[model samples]
Structure formats: C-alpha cells, structure tokens
Target chain A: MATFAVDKTKNTIRLTAMPKVLQGLTVITVLGLIVTLYLGYFNAGTDIQQGEIQRIFYIHMPTFFGAFTAFGATVLGGMLYLAKRDDKWDRLAVAGVEVGLALALINLITGSIWARPIWNTWWTWDPRLTSAAIMALTYAAYLMLRSGIDNLQTRRRFASVYGILAFSTVILTLVIIRIRPDTIHPVVIGASPQNAQGSFEATRGVVLALLPSLLFYSTIVPITLMWYRIRLENMLDVLEQKKIALLSEG
Target chain B: MNTPFFSVVMAIIRKDLQAELRSRELVATMLLFALLSVLAFSFALELDRLAREEVVSGVLWVTVIFASLLGLNRSMSIERENDSIDAMLLTPIPRSAIFVGKLVGNYLFTATVGIALLPLMTILYNINMLNLWVIATLLLGTLGICITGTLLAAMTVQTRAREALLPIVMLPVVLPILLAAVKATTGIINNAPVSDWQTWPQVLLIVDIIYLVLCLLMFSYVIEE
Candidate 1:
C-alpha cells in the first residue's frame, strides 16, 4: 500500500511536468519548422537543371536522414530492453518505429515527387529506392508482428529481436547507393558523385538552407515527437497498472 | 564419434526427415505448387522463344519462392500441432541445434521442390536450366532462403495470424537473398560475362553467412517460453 502511494505520487509528478515540456517543445518545433520552410523556399538557390523541383531535396534528403536516425534509436531501444527487461525501453522502441515510419513515408513520397521531375519516372527499381522500400516494409512487418502476438512478454521479446535484426535493412539502404556505382541516385559522400546523372552542386545558399533543415528534421523534430510519444505511453502504462491493481484488490 | 551438439542436430534432422518421409506432405505440396506455378507463368506470359529465354530465370525463381513458402509453413505447422516444439525445447540440447536442424530440413524440402521443377521449367520454356552453374546457384540460393525462412517461420508460428503472416514478415527481410539469387540465376541463363555476374555469388555467400550467424544467435530469444 505504501509502495502504491509512492507510485501514485511519482506518476502525478511526471504527468504534471510532461505537458509543460511538451508545450515548450511544440513552440520550438513550430518556430524551427517555419524557419526551415523559409530557408528552403526563399533562401536556397535554383538548381541548374531541375529548377524548383530540386527544392524537394531540402526535405527529401533530410527526412531520409531523420528516418535513419529514428531507426538507429529503435535498435538502441531494443538492445537496451533486451539487456535490462525494462518497459520504458520497449516503449522507446515502439515510439522510434512509429516515428520512423512517418519519416520514411515522407522520404518516399517526396522522393517520388522529386523523381518524376528528374528521373522522368515516378518510380524506379534503383538500388537506393529498392532498399528504402524494403526498409519501410520491413518495419511495417515489425509493427504487424507486435500486433499479432497476444502475450505481452512474448511480444516485447519478439519485437526486440526484430528491431535489432531489421536494422540490417537500414544499413543496407544507406550503403547500397555508395557501394553500387550503377545507381542513378547521387552519392553525397563517395566516389560515384561524378557519375551521378542529375545531381546538383550544393552552392552556398543551398548549403545554408540544407544545414538548418538537416538539423531540424533529423534531430529536433524526431526528438520532440518521441518525447510526446513516450509521455503518452507512460500515461497508458499508469492507467493499465491502476486497472490491474483494482481488479486484484476487488 | 559425434559431439553432443552434432548428435542433437543430426537427431532432430533425422526425426524431421523420418516424419516427412512417412507423411510425404510438405514436399508433395511444394512440388505440385512449384509445377503449377511454372505452368501458370507459361500460360500467362505466353512469351516467344527469345522472350522466354530472357524471362525463364525470373519465372523460375518466383515459382520456387512461392512454393517454398508453402513448404516452410507446413513444416513449422508440424511442430506447432503436437506440441513438438515444446518437446524439443524441453531437451537439454542447445537452441541452435534445433534451429540448424530445422534449417537443414527446410533446405532439403525447398531444394528438392526447386530442383524437380527445373526440368519442367526447361521443358515448358525450351531453355536449358540444367547447366552446372544454374544448379549450383539454385543450391546456394535455396540454402540462404531456407536458413532465413526457417528462423522467421519459428518466430511467426505462434502468432495469431500464423501461416498468413509468415511471408509478409519473411519476404522483405530476405530481399538480399532473393535479389542475389535471381541475379545469379539470370547471369547463368544469359551467359553474361563472368565479370558481370561474379558479385552475385559473393553477395549470396555474405548474406547467407550473416543471416546464419545472426539467426543462430537470436533463436534463443524467440524460443524462450
């Protein structure tokens, strides 16, 4: 009974503190999003070839990075949960996957829109595209696997195993472009940049716009979303515990 | 003189084979499914000789993959039905022994079905799929597929969705194997320059080794009651 009282107070403190933090984060993210949009639109220079369609790069590249970051978090969360058996880490893994899925969708959709203007096809089975599509599907299956299991502990264990294993796809997606020279996608960090067909040079203005967008989308937005998601999960956890406690006592 | 681990693995493999031979269920379904799928592809594609030669690799792999999915589900179902997995788990044998045993069993089932279909595919498309390179690629590729598929089937067998969920969870994870397999098969078929096709085998070998080690390491987690 004393422990239950302690639990109640702890839950209250966290519940009270969460919304203020979330409110502050919301204001900051909205401001940062606005600035990113301004930098992307009014500040970036026009591409030599792709024109305005090239501007999509400002979002597409950063979102892919963001999704990659989120997936990295998923793997970390899964590893920690497996090592420690903590529900918090499991929640973090769940949040990472959900947020990563959204970011990956943005990456794929913007990529499609961008490709139509540049590659002249809305979709191609290029290695990078194929890998990203597979990565998205892999995590989608991860989520489905979570839902299919009825036992909570078994579900968490399976999810941890999958979260760790499925990261191969993310690594494969990231490297396939750099490793394969035949890819049409530009190699931002490797030898095949010269071979890239429609890749534009990152000019001074483009670099400036790209910097903040990368920082914002890749870290700030994902962290903010994860914070809120974790808070919501904590609330659900507390309610579930309370319900179980009531049932046992009654 | 077999080490205990080897004995355990071999015993499980032998048990599975004895049961399968007695029932003849998994391989029969897989073989029939493979043949029907190949026939279906021929009817649907209706390609000329030149076109058929180009498409035979793709057609053959698609048929084999789908058929192997059927075999894998049935093989895992046997464990699920009589609490056979529980019986295996109750043993003191290492979890990896069970995994390797299932992997070898699935490999033989899927490979037998895949190899039997090759001649039929050759007859249907009038292309030679009997070459030594094509057969080698088939063996290596099916080994990779069965290793990954067996691990995933174990993970999925207890889920509420059971059989329906296996392919969804398995396919994307096994994309590297499928991609390399198809490329290697196509390379052998096209008689492309050795340089053009050399990477496929390398990729298959790496993917197979990685998946084998990873799945072995992770099997204990999935099998934990």
Candidate 2:
C-alpha cells in the first residue's frame, strides 16, 4: 500500500499513490449515499400534510450534522496545530473549513427549498436562520483572511486562533432554536417551540432512512473529502518548495 | 528589571491615552466617523418618526461598531509603524498584560464614542436614548467589540489588506453582540416591560465575558514572533 510521508530535511511531502483503504471508503460512502436516498424516496411513506416535498428532509437535516462534524474537526485541527506547531494539522484545519462550508451551504439551500413550500417564504429574519447565515460567513471569512497573510508560520498561527474562536458561531446556530422562543425553525428531536412550523414526528421508516444518511454524511463524506483535501495541500506545499529551490539555483 | 503585571498594563494604557491627548487623532476620527454614520443612516433609512424610533437602536450599534473598527485598525497600525510591537515584546512583564492594557485603552476610546452618541441620537431621532440601561448595554457591547477587535486588528495589521480585512473578519463574529444590543436598546426605547428586554442585556454580558477571556488567552499567540 502506498503511504504519505513528509521529509523534514528536504522540506518535501510525498504520496506515492492513493491508499487502498481511502479508495474503498470512498466507494462505500458513495454506495451508502445511494442506499439512503433509496430508503428516503422509495421506502419511507409520504407525509400527510407536506406531501412529496418532505423527502428533502433526509438530505436537509443530515447535511447540518455533516457541517457540524466538519466544523468540529476544524476546532480540533486548530487546537492540535497550535499545540504541536505542525503543518499537517494546519492543513487539516483548512480542509475542515472547506468541507464544512460546502456542507453548511447545502444545509442552508435545502432549508430554503423546504421553507418555500411550507413557510411560503424563501427566507426570514428568524433567529435560527440568521445565526446559520452568520455561521457560514464566519468560516468564509476564515478562508479570505487566511489567504491574505503572506508569512506561512504567521498564517498558520493566526488561522488557528481564529478557527478556534469562530466555533462560537456554530454553537450559536445550534442552540438559537432552543433558546429563542420566537424562532419558527423546527426542532427534530425534542419538543419544538410552540410557534414552530412544519415539524413532523420521527416514525420508524423515517428513522431508518435518516439514521444511515446522517451517519454517512457526518462521518464518511467529511472524512473522505478532508483526507483528499489534506493530500492536495501537501502536494501543493511540495510544489511551492520546489519552485523556491529552482529560483534560488537559477 | 522585571516590571509588575498591573503596572505594565497601566503604563501601556497611560501611553495610549497620552498619545491620544497629544494628537487627539484616534478618538476624533472615531467620533466624527460615528456622527457622519448616524447622519447618513437617518437620510438613507428615510423613515417616518414612528419607524425611526424602531430603527434608531440598530443605527446606533452599527455606527459604534464601524467607528470602533476604525480605531482598532489605526491603533494596531501605529504599533506596527515603528516596530513598537516588537519593543513591547522585549519587555519583562507578561505578554497578556500588554493585551489587557491595549484592550482597556481601546475599550475606553470606543466606549467614549458610544456614550457620546446617546444624546446625539436622542435629539436627532426624538427617542429617549440617554437611559442608564441603554448606556450599560452600550458599554457591554463595545467591550465585546474591542476585545475581539484588538486581537483581530493585531492579526490584520500584519496582512496585505490591513484595514479592509478587519470588518469582514469581525462583523460575523460580533453579530451576537449586535443582536443583543439592538434588542435591548429597542425594547428600552419602546418602554417595554423590564422582563421583555432584560435577557438581551444578560446575553450581552455573557458574550462580553466570553470574548474577553478568549481574546486574553489568544492575544499572545497572535502578537508573538
């Protein structure tokens, strides 16, 4: 099996080839997504009130957890990077933001799609909605600010600190529904607020379909994508070092 | 010679305040920017008197936030101009004392601008903005802004786009403070029951504490060589 290695003296990173394990996991994750889609569309019964539009819930809700998991990795990667001063952890942090952002965007877009039919508006200034939007912007700022720094070491350090602090937005987005009484966003697990709209019970088939999708999205999808991203970053670092060396020689 | 921590903090604060007193640049710019922002908001919003009362609080917080952004960027850039930050790092006192000192100086300047805006807004909008609760909310919210702003300003001042990056990075982080402050101010202005708006101030306090602690812990990391 090919392996990933970093040479300290030469300042180079090498990945001979894709590992068989990651290849297998990617295939498994794709297959899992297909199975979950089948279970959601074909196996689960339609809702009495919301009708055909409700199946999007399978993707909508799970993608949020997917985002939560990815952002959580960012916090972890940030802390580890700061403590160890390792470039690999910095790469992990960057990967987390990219993957987390994609998942968060999916969550927001799906929620809007679901809300259009049910709530009769594509967007509202509700607490939950606003916080989710802020959460996405916080990480988007992370990427923009990260690229604006020139020194690699300072970039990594500042990115770590900012990454750790930015998690507050994610926490706020998660808890805003529970804390703010006026939010119309529904809670799936617990008793939703009195004014919550479009909340449905988690029946057996719904649970069966949702559980696998949630597991796959929150675990397999983010891990696989972040792994690939980290590999790409390592390769980029190697190219950067080679360019510098060529410049010095010339 | 090892300088004591509190003394180090006081010295930094004294230095910043003395510099401002000599030139009157930071606070003057912030106050003027804040005043212009209030005027611009009033004209742009173009609300009726009743609607103006509802929106005046949002305008107040937004102006304070942007003004503080200006002060924060200038404050750190001054440190960078002559490598004053490196000199401070060579001192014997703890690094966090430097953070605390800069934080207090920034907080004081921003809070001054926020407090001055109260009466100006009251006269302009015909809403009672000089209440004690509103002032308290302003102090708490600006404290939160300065805490994060000081840390981020230090980071952004070292970047290619120094001034432009501060708001883009800071606004989303401080959105909670803006939400709480605006809610509290609006409720107070509308003469709502104490119970109606009390939680907003409490939220402001909690967020302020959280940002203060986080900034104190991370400030050294940001400014370190």
Candidate 3:
C-alpha cells in the first residue's frame, strides 16, 4: 500500500508518481520564493542606519530559524531511532543534519555579509556568531565521526547517540545568547542584546517579506531537501544491497 | 556479599591506576605533550609583559584540552587493544560502572597532567598560573572534559583513525567548558570581581552534570553494539 516499491530482482525502487507532500511542498516553495523575492526587492523598508544591507534579514533570519529546526528534527529522529531502532529514523537524522548544516552555512554567510557593512568587519567574535561557528564545527565533526565508523549497525547506533550528545552545543548556543550579556548580536524577537546597534521592530513591510521567507526557509525548503535526501539514501541502500547480493551469488 | 557497584567502580579504577603505575606511559606522554605545548606557545607568540599575563589562561586551557585528548585516546585504546573490552563487556558488572571507572581513571590522569603543567606555565609565562581559583577552574574544567572525553574515546577507539578522530570530535563539543574555564581563570588573574566570572563555574557545573548523566545512560548502547 505504499506509493513506492522496491523490485528485489532488479534492485530498483519505482515510484508511480511523486508523493503528494513533495508535490505540494514544491508548489509552496515556488510560490514562497516568488513572494520573498518580490517583497525583498519592493516592499521591505530600508533601515535608517543599516540601509539596504539590513534587507538580508528576510532571507538570513529565516535560514537561521530553519537551521535550528533542522537540528531539532535531527534530535527527534535520533531519539526515535534509539527507541525503535529503525533505519528510516537514522536516515531522517542524518538528512536533517546535512540539511541543517547547509542552512546554517547560508545563515552564517548572509549574517557575515550583513555584518561587513554594519559592524564594519566581516567577522567579529560576537557571541552569536562565535556560537554559530562552533555549532557548525560540532556537526561537521559528527558527520566525520560517522564516516570513520565501518560497521553499519554500530555506526547507526553511535551516530544516534552522538547526534543526541552533539545537540548540547545547539542548546548551549541558543541558551547562551539569552542568558549571557557578552553578545553584541541583536535579539530580534526576544530579550535585549547586550550592546544592540541596529535592532529594529518588524514593521509592516518587513513582516510581509519575513513571514513568507520563514514559510519557505523554515518549512518548505528544508522538508523538500529532506525528501530528496531520503530518496537518495534509499537508492544508495538499494545499490549497496545489490552489490552484496551479487558478490555472495558469485 | 558481592561487591556493590561503587566497589566495582573503585576496583576497576584501582586496576587502571596499578597498570598506569606499572607502565607510567599515559601520564608521561601527556605531561611531556603539555610541557611541549607550553614551549611552542611561548615560542610562537611574543609574550611580552602584558601579553604574558593575558595569554596565560588561554595557553593553559588550549594545552590542557589537547593534552587531555592524548590521555583519553590512550586510556580507551588500552582496553581495546587485547580483547580486554570484550572481556569487560562479558563481565557481570553493570555497564555504567565501566563508564564510571574509566571516567574516574581518566579524570585523575588528566588532572595530574593539568597540575604538572601549572608550575611550568608559571615559570614560562612569568605570571603565577598556580593560584587557588585557577586550580579550581582547571579541576572543574578537566572533570567536564574527562566525562565527555571518556565516552567519546570509547566510541572512537573502535574506529580505524582512533587518535585523529578523538580531538576532531571532542574539541568543538568541549569548547564551552574551555571557554568558561578560560574566562574564570582570566577574571581571577586580572583581579576582577567574582560576580563577573561567577557564571562560568555555574555553567561548567551544569554542563558537567548534563554530560555525566547522558553519557551514563548512553554507554550501554555504545558498548553493546
């Protein structure tokens, strides 16, 4: 009763049609992209101080939110994998991490680009930026650790546990920004930044641009990426199984 | 009566200490590495009078973290070398006890290396690195490292690139602890008010407890499969 089926003899999974979720997600993503580009170019008001560079917030903030959500999904997938020992959950966990890494990279680059004109430097050791860099490094280490492991079951198990453990960095990064007073990064939606420079309220034009950007980056974009990544993972698994079967048969 | 879990843990720690005492390999290398790291930092950076005072805390922590990686790698690899981990897994003792035992042993070895480096750092940096508050921070920080490092080392020991992978996996994860430790140490060295730096130890304590509990709960999975 599934939409896709794997042919064991041929070692290929055939999909009759795209799943409804993927199809719907694609439509929403296209619509969201057009709306975001329109708003970014037309509607969002330029900042009094930061000028046009502040427009990056439309994409930057949403990617930051999306990256956090991806990491959260990784934790959820990891916890479920541990409880159920399912390969699907492991696939979800890794896909979440990889997608999250890409999102985080985008968020960092945009934030850095935004910073260059405002903060007068491309990089500073601001607490939020520092923590983001560290978070990226931690997850990079997670993927590297996964590669070093050879056995399939053991790798899955260790990666799951590590996935859970590495989440501590994410928690620390999120919590530190609020609790600690050393950060110069603006707290957009929450408590005050220590030495806020260009923080602003979400004006009508800004919110119009931001809301759809959030819809795309935080939900539509990551889920679509996850869907494709999972499909690729399944195909890889099929090819690996076919190779093993062929070797044993010979 | 059979030995309790604590005694089992203590006994394992004793076995580790006795083996370390007999061979003196892990601590020796760790200490030498720590010392050499200090020399390298001093040579690489022109530690003038003000620079020496400011750089001591950062140098001390970076050295300790890397040196602890060396100790962590050896501690776990020793168990995995001769089918010993398999024998330990087969034993009647609880798996968490195995974790506690290795954790305690690693804590002691890393702590010793940290302590040994203090006097050398004091002499090289021309600032007194051997202060009470600094030692307290070092102990607290090393305790955090030992808990996480021991668990991660166990996971990495099963891999082919055991030595290379431990630091890569560990350093970033342990950055918060090192950051807090350095902050507290710097505050103390500069005679800043305790209120400014008090948050670091509290953060370190919370991080330590979180890592300890999670590593304990998760060790059974890592050791089993």
Candidate 4:
C-alpha cells in the first residue's frame, strides 16, 4: 500500500508537514511584489521610443523571458527523460512544460492586450507574437499528447520525445522567417532594421520586474509538481486498497 | 560489419506500402475528404475574383492540412483496429525502421493530395498554379507536415478519444510548419522577390529533420506498450 500510495518507502527524516516548502512560496510572493514595485519606480521618468504604453513592457518582457526559460527547461527535461527513462525525469518534464505553457499563455494574452493600446489592434502577426503563440500551442499539444496515453511508461516516453522534437519548431520559428521573410511578420535581424519585430530591449526597471516574476514562477512549479505527484500516488493507493479488500473477502 | 540497415529500411517500406495498397482504404478516404474540403471552402469563399487570388494559398493549404489529418488518423486507427501494429511489432525489425517506413507511407499519401490539389485549386480559383517554386514549397511543406503528423498520429492512436484528440494535438505541434508554409507559399503567389522567401525553406527543412530524428529515437518507447 505504501509503495502504491506515497512511493517514499523508507522515509528518511519524515517531518510530516513541509514548512520550508510553504515558507518558500510565501517568500517568493513577497519578493516578487517588492521587485515589481522597484521596477515601477525605476521606470518613472524613462519613456520608450516605440511610444504607446511602454509601461506594459515591465510586465511583458519578463514573462516572455521566463516563459522561454521554462520552455528551455522543458526541452532539457525531455532530453533527460529520454536518456534516463526515469519517471522522475518525466515528472520534471511535465512540470516544466505545464508551467512554461502557462507563462507562454500569459505572454500571448498580455501581448495582445498590450498591442490593443500600442498597435491599435488586438493582434498582429509580429514575429515575436506569432512565434510565441505557436510555442504556446505546440507545448499545449504536448500536454494533449501526454493525456491521450494512460499507460504511465508509454505516456512519459512519447511526451518527452515529442517535447524534444518541439525544439525543432522553435528553430523553425526563427530560421523559417529568415528564409522566407516576405510574409506578414517582421524579421528580427539581418535584412533591415525595418524588418525587426517587437523590440525585446530590456530597460533596467524591466529587468527588476522580470527577475522576481521569474523567481515567482520557478518557485510555484515544483510545489505544484509535488502536490500532483502526491495526488497520483494517493489515487493509486486507494485502487490497491480496493483490490486487496476484494481479494480478502473472496 | 554492415548492419543491413538499408535493406531493413526497404523491407519496412515495402511492407507498409503493400499493406496500404491491399487496403486502399486510407487514400480513398483522404482523397474524398480533401475534395469535400476544397469544395466547401470554394463555396464558402464564393470565388470572388480578387478573393481567389488573395486567398489562394490559404485555401490550398487548409484543405491539405485537414484532409491529411483525416488520413493520418485513419492510418494508425486501421493498424490498431486490425492489430496489425502489434503483429508488425512481432517482427525482428528495428523499431526505428517502422517509424521511417510509416513516415514514408504517410508522406506518399499526403503528397498525392498535394500534387492533385494543384490543378484542382488552379482550375477552381482560375489562377495559373504551375510554378517551380510552388511545387517545391508544396513538396517541402507537405513533407514537414507528414514528418510530425505521423509521429503525433501514432502517439494518439492508442488513446480512448482517438478521433477528437489527434488533430487538436497535431495542429498545435505543427504550427511552425503551417505558419512557415503559408507564409512561403503566399510569398510565392505574390511573385515577391527571392529575398522574401529567404528563411522558411531552411527552417521547415530543419524542423523536418529534427522531428525525423526525434521520432526514431522515441518510437521504440511509444510502441513498446
């Protein structure tokens, strides 16, 4: 039952409640707020050249960076799982993708909302926005791929491989545009300054807001992961108990 | 020592081709669905003159994508239904060979639609559709789509919600291919300068290779169950 339930067979130093984990979350939130406030203060007098609501960049750029980092982590986790074939590695891959997928979603939503005020439209196929949208969608598909398979082993294997393959599309996002630049989205480099998509140049305050937000994000992901793992093991335990009870009754 | 890798590839490819030819079920369904999609979009778009010119690429690609999804879904579903996939697994072939062979089969079927759609769409839209670049992009784009789609289809085939789930998972994963293909094809249509299509071919091709390699490595794991 313990094997099926918690999987923590020979518990080393079981303290029951994980105070540090709880305290970790609280500290992340508090620090995130302080950093955000500091960012807002630093941006006080500096105005953006691209004009419209440069203020939003404080929130937006960090989200993009953090999301990219999470995706990078997801891909890395996928590689690790494929090499190691450990469920622990697969768990980390899932954790990274889910959190990364969320941040990517937020990046898209906030970018669109910000675009409305800046670009005077809800959306533009700007390279950054279009690529980010595709990234979110790609990883979201990675989630569905995970869900479609119920066998724990196969699910982990296939999803991790798919996750690794996703990096190709990210490459496609950059190079494909460079190869065929005449479409709607602006190119970020090489041809002309005019071809550049939304600027990612980070102001110092943008950096402040960005750093804490990433910290907040990184902190939340593992806890959610541990919680999900616990639930999964608990569900398995209940199933085992029912099976055992039936056998004993017979 | 030589491993007979090439022979293994040919054998798997031949087997898959033989299976599809014997069945003839997947291509027939795909062709019908492809025709239906093109027809629906034609009527829906109402063939406005400028509209046809402007949306030529969109109309052509969407039809191909949706039809290919139907074919991709059916390909694995049929294998599972007949337990052929399991039987195939019983063979002593390397699982990676199976992945490559399935990809070849998928590309053959999808590319047939790609070739057929050229004249069909040209006639329907009343535009000159034959061009070197157009054909090149068609081949490249469909290959990119099939490369990933085959992998996704195999993964989704064993699931309970097979039908509804395959495309939802596939489309998102292939967004880059879709975006690049559409953009490149659209550029070709507009007769834009070469500078216009400088990146997509390279990007799409790189993506195709990456998926091809990754699919091979992971396919053994996928079918192991």
DockQ of each: 0.70, 0.78, 0.71, 0.52
True contacts kept of each: 0.76, 0.78, 0.71, 0.63
Query: What are the lDDT figures for the candidates, one per model?
Result: 0.84, 0.92, 0.86, 0.70
In model 3 chain A, the worst 10-residue window by lDDT is: A1-10
Error of 3 at A174 (Å): 2.3
On residues A114-182, what C-alpha lDDT tens digit does candidate 3 reach at each position? 888888899998877888889998899889988998898889988988888888777777777686677
Q: After superposition, how far is residue B27 of candidate 4 from its true place, in Å?
A: 2.0
Which of the two, 1 or 2, has more TM-score? 2
Candidate 1 chain A worst ten-residue window by lDDT? A1-10
lDDT of 1 by residue, A59-97 (tens): 988998888888888988988887898888898899989
> Chain B TM-score of model 2, please?
0.97
What would the per-residue lDDT of candidate 3 be over residues B128-149, giving only the tens digit for each residue? 7777888888899999999989
lDDT of 4 by residue, A1-250 (tens): 1233333576222224444655566566666657675665564335566553555555554565556566666677778887887666776677667766776677677767767754678987666556667777788878777777787777778878777777654555545455444444433223434454454455455555556655555545334444455445455545766777789999
The true-versus-predicted C-alpha distance at residue B53 of model 3, in Å, is: 2.8
Cα lDDT for residue A150, candidate 4 = 80
Q: What are the per-residue Cα lDDT tens digits for candidate 2 across A1-250?
A: 5545568787566667788879998899889888989989999999889998899999998898888988999989989998899888999999999999999999999999999999999999999999999999999999988999989999999999999889989988988888788899989888999999999998898898899999989999999989988888877777777788899999
Off by over 4 Å in 4: A1-29, A41-43, A46-53, A123-130, A167-250, B1-3
Model 1, which residues run further than 4 Å from truth? Answer: A1-16, A19-28, A178-183, A188-197, A246-250
